[model samples]
Target: MRVVTMLHVEGELDQSRHAAIEHAVARAAGEVAGLRRSHLGRHYPGTVGGGQYTWDVLFDGRDPAALRQAPALLELVEEGALRLDTVAFERQHLSVPEPGIRDCVKRTLLLRVLPDTPPEAVERFERDMLGMPRYIDAIRNWAFSRADPELHPTPWTHVWEQEYRELRGLQEDYMLSPYHWGLVDGWYDPESPQRIVDTNLAHVYCPAATTILGWEA
Candidate 1:
């Protein structure tokens, strides 16, 4: 299973708190029961809403309780040192199959489709979103999944994740493509009748050395 936990430092993080928090988070991750790999870092400059840092973790199984009981993590939140949002989903429908694992930039979009949306419209939204990679070649590998609301309690309904060889692949090719701005973007554009996504969405990316999209199983 793959889970993404994003955080924003709530206030000034002096050097001392910074070191302690970093160490605490590292220790917590190592102790989590099903943890396989952990990627924690500030997002690349080009993206938005991904918070200050993203803790993208992979697990052998879904152990929600164990993740919550992560040692010393609650104290940081209590101390007003960090703000967090997390979503976990493992059943991925690949829009673009991965080439292979290598050093790359990992990006994720966590969005919400309003509960009142009719079923047919939601289906169309999903289809249009999946269609994006067909025209934007920079999206080397991609998966889009609907998150289970029971697991996270966050309103987010879907997760869109992908990897690019470099930032320019996303910044220039993907962002600048006609399919993005002209075609698939309507689902996210508030002014458009096709919009299904909540305006408050997370667009975050970070440097990754291994494939976080999970090709193994």
Candidate 2:
């Protein structure tokens, strides 16, 4: 299973606290033998609430056991900074599926557009584009919504993650569909959405091997 840890700081995090936190994180990484690959990044300016800093640490492991030991690693950070509000989840068990471990291509895209637009409309658009009958077939998973309240640093915006599977059969079926469009633009409306701010896309690769830690349900 893959695990994602979200840490939100209540106020401006001091430099001292930041250093200690990073140090502890590094130490924990060293201690966890089962970690296959880990990535840590801070949320961009528009992604968090006012006067707060958010960071996400992602761990890819073979099994739940590997993630079970994650808290111990986080405890090290807590001991070092003592100034953070943290939440964690075994990604596969959480609301959002763990794209890192699933056999699919993972993509995270940040979209900032007009506010007050119902989420249903956005979801509908995505479904229409990705669900088209005549298009290259790809095992795809998509969701759209406003950013988490605690994580929305800016007003009137949100982020989304999309997953596509590279299955030859699916791809062939998509090609025969009438809705097939050669380019991504055929699906996503960059301007119609309006109020554009920022956009980003990432292609994620899932490692073949993983380690399981002692995790309790």
Candidate 3:
């Protein structure tokens, strides 16, 4: 039972507050059962998508109820440090070769399907998304979800996540993969108002330390 918690951060923050935020998150990580990995990342400035900073918490064999009660999460809420826009939890949906415990890069996408899109079409789109890894070998790990309104009441309905060994692979291999340009791109049109995608890439951080730094590799 893998669980991921995505926090959409808001409110004024300075360097001091930022450090405190990370500390709170780390404190929560220690208190939560099954929370083996955690990442607190700030999106690159001027990016066209995603939250300003995302707190990605990964838990194994933990329930969503327990996750909400995480000490760090509770502390943030109680202290008014976080103005959460969205909170989503998803289990592992697609299987790929595990990237193991090493440092890697990750891309997270928040998607919203047009209201006018047919239900059957939406279902088909999901099937195609799940099959993406078969065609793009650059993706080292992947997981995603079409949010359940009852559990995840966020405006976005779909969440896509993937890991890569290096950013170059993401750009040269995954982005240029025939499967992406030929098949996936056809399904998504930037010009179309019917669909929305907000993507952000970040260095992967585990319990032990921050990993996958530097852009040279």
Off by over 4 Å in 2: 49-159, 162-217
Candidate 2's clash total is: 21
How well is each residue in 1-217 modelled by candidate 1, as lDDT tens digits?
7677888777666778667767877988887887888877667776677667788777775665466468668777777777778887766687436656588888888999987999999999888888888888889888888886666666789999888988888889988999899877888899999887889889988888867675433
Residue 160, model 3, lDDT: 75
State which candidate has the highest lDDT.
Answer: 1
Predictions in order: lDDT: 0.79, 0.39, 0.59
**TM-score leader:** 1
Q: Which stretches of candidate 1 lie over 4 Å from their true place?
A: 13-19, 95-101, 215-217
* Residue 85's lDDT in candidate 3: 42
Put the candidates in TM-score order, highest first. Answer: 1, 3, 2
Model 3 RMSD, rounded to 1 decimal = 5.7
Candidate 2 matches the true fold with a TM-score of 0.36
